[model samples]
Target: MLLLEKGIGGKSLLDIVKVVHLTKRIIPLFWGAFLSIFILFLPGRVWAIQNSYKVGIEDVLSITVWGEPELDKTVVVAQDGTINYPLLGNIAVAGYTVKEIDELITRLLAADYLVNPQVDVMVKEYRSQKVLVLGEVLHPGLYILTGPTSLLEIISRAGGVSDKVGNQVSILRSPVEERKIKDNEHASTSVEEKEAKSILIDLEELLKGRDLAKNIYLEPGDIVFLAGKKDTNISEQQVYISGRVQKPGAYEYQKGLTALNACIMAGGFDK
Candidate 1:
């Protein structure tokens, strides 16, 4: 009986080892199949983790290639999205990520007898980050937005809202139609009219401690505006009080307005 029990235990141990080995092999195969399927379903142009630079018209960029000093040059991006390089000569670098520019420079250098070139690109000065502030701001003009600048930051830099107006502001961004218009030159909308789509931002809510999801990163050519909010109170219900009062002008007749105070602003009812 003891020999029979030992034989059963040994058989069980062998079965356990076989099951563990089978699981180890099957798990790796399952994981590989899942990873392959996921990769196959991913977007073709997977954007790398990158820091994008906003290229403005007339912004200067310094490019340096190690071991190839002849290709080093400081170039300004033109308004038409083109840059002049030493050897490449008028390569379009605007709207391209820095990594893309680096790869392009590497290819250019390799063509001209340099192997495995090391390229460095830097923005020496940013002159192209300007946005326009219109409407009820005390000063309305083109304001420069530096790195990571948002709509509220640009508006605050523009000297706040006018005292006479409420805090409803409109941030006008050219609509998607603008892109279509650029693509199709013969589109019906005029250039001036096509540039009219803008997103509205409420500064009053922002001031009132509202969530700031409405405030987004402001781009070049964006128009920030402060427009007046319509007063819902009935004008007819307000009492017109002029003269030497503690607070002059129209007051809500329901509370706080007396005939005696109204006379004060109007020179205190002639004795």
Candidate 2:
């Protein structure tokens, strides 16, 4: 009835009783408009995070040229971080993203060959960025990180950490980290270094926080290590049972195993 007074018309008193309405129907439309404006003009914009990789030495990339198969090629990044293309002969590709590489190739081709060439550069082999697991890992070795990979992921790939090892582990960021620590005094030190010493990526922290960001992005020749914890002295503990036991076996005496439990395991002196 109050809404009818505000122009929400009802047929009669009986109709008004039946049609209990609120303010103008435009209220929903107004709210919808407000929501739209809020979303569109939001101060902070959320962006889709992208995983990027820097091309490195010895990495192999496959270059595809649409409608120009002759220009298509597979080239290994040289020790000096360069590649030999058809016309671009010995172009440096390291430190450039795949998109940048494509643009570079397109520019090179348009300058001489095609009017507007389509260049596609893909990492056929990601030998450039490999995760190296060493020290106390069950299967410590070099693991190729083809795509998105993390500390726990790499550890799982390496057959999980050795039971003897503790949660303490470290990840060394690749060539950059190496160069950063070197005596290249002329090199400009970036913010990464200021945080590198004490804030080097810790595996324990990653395991706790479940945050992949805590785990450093692995690169070629990056070394990861699992530190060993205190050893359990199994040599000193021993258990022996003597009697008419079925399938009798010697069980190692552990922290809390009792004589009765050991006997029960050995068929309990069968009558």
Candidate 3:
């Protein structure tokens, strides 16, 4: 009986070893098949991720290298605007477009580790970009922007414009520096050259879909102000209708009023 039990135990141990070996061989094949499907569907869904978006801090990224699945990783851009790549340490990826980062990674890998590596970059999450929506929006606050968002899309995200919102909307933007200067060329100016700019959009035309050009893309830090029913602040605007007019006097200046209308408002032109 002891001999039979020992023989049976040895056979079971051999079977267990065979099963573990089979699992080891099948795991890589399963992983490869899964990755093949992911790569196949990636191009089809490429339109969902705008290629025009620039990378930013805290944005999650999925980077993959074909034929080398071990290099694929999902990483978040650090506050220093960089990502830690395998064997490359920290590489600055933020403030750069994904295409640029792809080219960079491809070049680095080819130079250091691989030969003619095919790389793909995709943003898994856009946690960096944001826009502030205020004034007359049902949910007036900050909104996290994910893709190519138009003015109308942002309005909708804020629960659409409130009933009190007027036909005009104002977008306040901050100017960014266009060029980089070397240390020797840099000037010691107390004030930055960036200036505040305001864009006026005709919301009435935009919402009606009559003029799509009125729809504008929102940038980071852009403030959307919806004009309400309150009167616009006018700083002493008086139009004088004096020449050849009966009872000529000063009138309140209003937009779209022609010269004839102005004269009529000042008691009409003398006959």
Candidate 4:
């Protein structure tokens, strides 16, 4: 009985090993199939997200009406957040999404000109809402916003922070009321004199994910400026170790470096 039990136990172990090996071989194929499906559906998901993006000023749009080729037109949103469509005159579409625009145009066309008109709206170019990122960041420049973008997202789009980035970040945003007044052409000189509101954030806390509230959603026409650790230029960073030191010359200056360390790097004392 002992011999039979031992033989059965050995067979069970062999079967377990074979099953584990088979599972290992099958797992890769299963993941490959899953990844293929994900890849196939990624473009559709991206299109859905982009389609929901609100139209803004200076954004180029392509409007097409089915069965009416003459009605197909490419138009650009004006500064006042309006577009001129043929027979429709000036239509406000700054804050409306592409789907909303399509529905609106379809409804208007059916009400007056055509019966059951089908309309399609597509964003040809994104130029309306933009933010400027500068100072202590890699590739600092202006970036266009597709949707609701956060401060961190714009910073990431500018290629993240540089090595010399400091602990503080400043965001300059125009007042909402001021912008509204300006848009209406009723802004006074006093409103123009009012500077943009400055928001200071602790970069250390933000980067560590400790103060998530500091990662506020950025607005269009906002300016982001990142502070630096030192104001000195890289070319001007040098330590002159001349007195009583061997190989005394200009040594590269680094943060928290002391005179003793500089002397040591210069080959110690002259003796």
Candidate 5:
């Protein structure tokens, strides 16, 4: 009551309430205007995002030349990150950005061949960024990594781990990771110092419980291997023949091994 009596500039409670009400109305107007401007600029933002994607190996490209159907053709990037075009034979398109390659083809054709070549390059399919997911997961194989994906997300993508964490889920980031690091490092690391890096993830910690830290981001070409269920592995493994057997104890497990064969391996069942 005392604070209300001593309101801003000796204003009464009623005056303060009216001012707050006015402020509430004005805030929505400002927000609406800001959102309108932001919405208007969204198309440009999307265009920029699309323009920033670089071309890579195995990516299908839809390239067309305006007014010249003969020169227009869709091509896939080769293993060496190159494309075979009419004028440019075996042009290296890998590593080079889409815009760069577009300008290059345009310039090359105009210089020696076409008077004014019009080139349009668009990625029909992106195949360069992918990872290999193998082992105990339900669906394990090559997974396309469209964006930043965590280990946990990948496990879910592979239908989760076989059995929580019976076996370790390891990521073998070999020459692929090493090559990228060397490329970004400006060759700071020598060949001798460069080594393949590996990461072992505990799926039990993640699936069975909360261990957010175990979720690490994966890179293209990384191999994520999840081991099979420990219980299944144990059972499907060695077959033991003991009680009343000639030679008891554990014995090697061979497919289609009957009880008699097991007894034979154990020096024949005891009479």
Candidate 6:
């Protein structure tokens, strides 16, 4: 007589064993496929994010060379976007990725100083990229930009807009000629020759996500001004009725009020 234990749902022990065995095989396949996808996609996404950051002026950098103690040093990028390295007097590192800087230093060192040099670079202090936020903000001041930052992001960093803010915001940006001069180009061009341009954004549209294109990315040295409401209530708005008026004081301003009406309201110009 063969022994057959009954299991749940009127299934035999043999049937349950078969289901468990199938599950064991399927689980590995599922995990393997999931890991394959993760491995294939995750690295590229991470690399793209890392490569997007570029060095800028006033940024401090820590650089090292494998097997060369003398080549390791911390350098601050100058206003001109350059750094003085050992055996390499001055190198332009602004607008370059860490990996690019590594390759650049390695190639230069291998040219005459070292053989098969391995180099590494890291940002010690991010002081270069900055923007100024002013007018009608909770905290009006300067902010640092670590990466690609948008106008809305900076405003949030400054504690968001104040309650008295208006419906629009203005951005004053450096002209193209000035930007080119900063990049070590157009040596003869004067920054004063070109006027900075102003960009107005509808705050209502931006905050509501109605028009995302208006939420522009902020650049270094950009100034963001949140204007206050010009059309405030009568209490907040006043007109000076003085000199020849009986009530030689500030009176509440009313729309369409003429000089004669103002004088009449002030008791007919001092009687």
The 10-residue segment with the lowest total lDDT in model 2: 6-15
Per-residue lDDT for 8 in model 4? 10
Give per-residue CA lDDT, model 3, range 10-127, as digits (tens).
Answer: 1110000010000111122332343344335544344754576777768899999999888999999875567888977777776567877788889888987999999999988887
Q: What is the TM-score of candidate 1?
A: 0.54
Estimate the Cα RMSD of every predicted model relative to the unseen true structure: 28.4, 26.2, 26.6, 23.0, 24.6, 25.3
Off by over 4 Å in 2: 1-51, 173-205, 208-213, 232-271
Give per-residue CA lDDT, model 2, range 1-271, as digits (tens): 1010100001000000112112111112332343344335534332211125566666789999999999889999875556888876877776566766787788878987899898888877766555556444455555776555556566666656544555566553322322221121212222132111112445455555566576554544444655544463434434443333454445554433332344456674344
Q: What is each predicted model's overall lDDT from 0 to 1? A: 0.48, 0.51, 0.58, 0.60, 0.54, 0.59
Show pairs that collide, candidate 4. Answer: none
Ten-residue stretch with the least lDDT total in model 3: 13-22
User: Residues 1-271, candidate 1, lDDT per residue (tens digit)?
Assistant: 0000001111110000010000111122333343344335545323421336545456678889987778788888775556877756666665555666677677777877687889987776666555556544445566654455666556556555544345566664532111111221112122232433546556656644484687678765554655533442223343343322234344443222222222343343221
lDDT of 5 by residue, 154-262 (tens): 6666655444235467775534322121221111222222334567767666544467677677865565766544444333345444444466666655433333344
Each candidate structure's count of clashing pairs: 9, 0, 0, 0, 0, 0
Q: Is candidate 1 or candidate 2 better by lDDT?
A: 2
Q: Indicate which candidate wins on lDDT.
A: 4
Model 4, 1-271: lDDT tens per residue? 0000001111110000010000111122333343344335545555674677777768899998989999999999876667888877877776678987797788778878899998989988887666656555565556777766777767767666666666778776633222212121111112232334678899888766699799888866565777666652444345444534576566665543432344468785443
C-alpha TM-scores of all predictions: 0.54, 0.54, 0.60, 0.60, 0.50, 0.60
Position 124, candidate 1: lDDT: 67
lDDT of 6 by residue, 1-271 (tens): 0111112111101101111000111122333343344335544554553355577777888999989999999999776667889887878777677777787888889988999998888877877666656555566666777766777777767666655667778776633222222322212112332445667889877766688798788866565767656663334445444443456555665543333354457675232
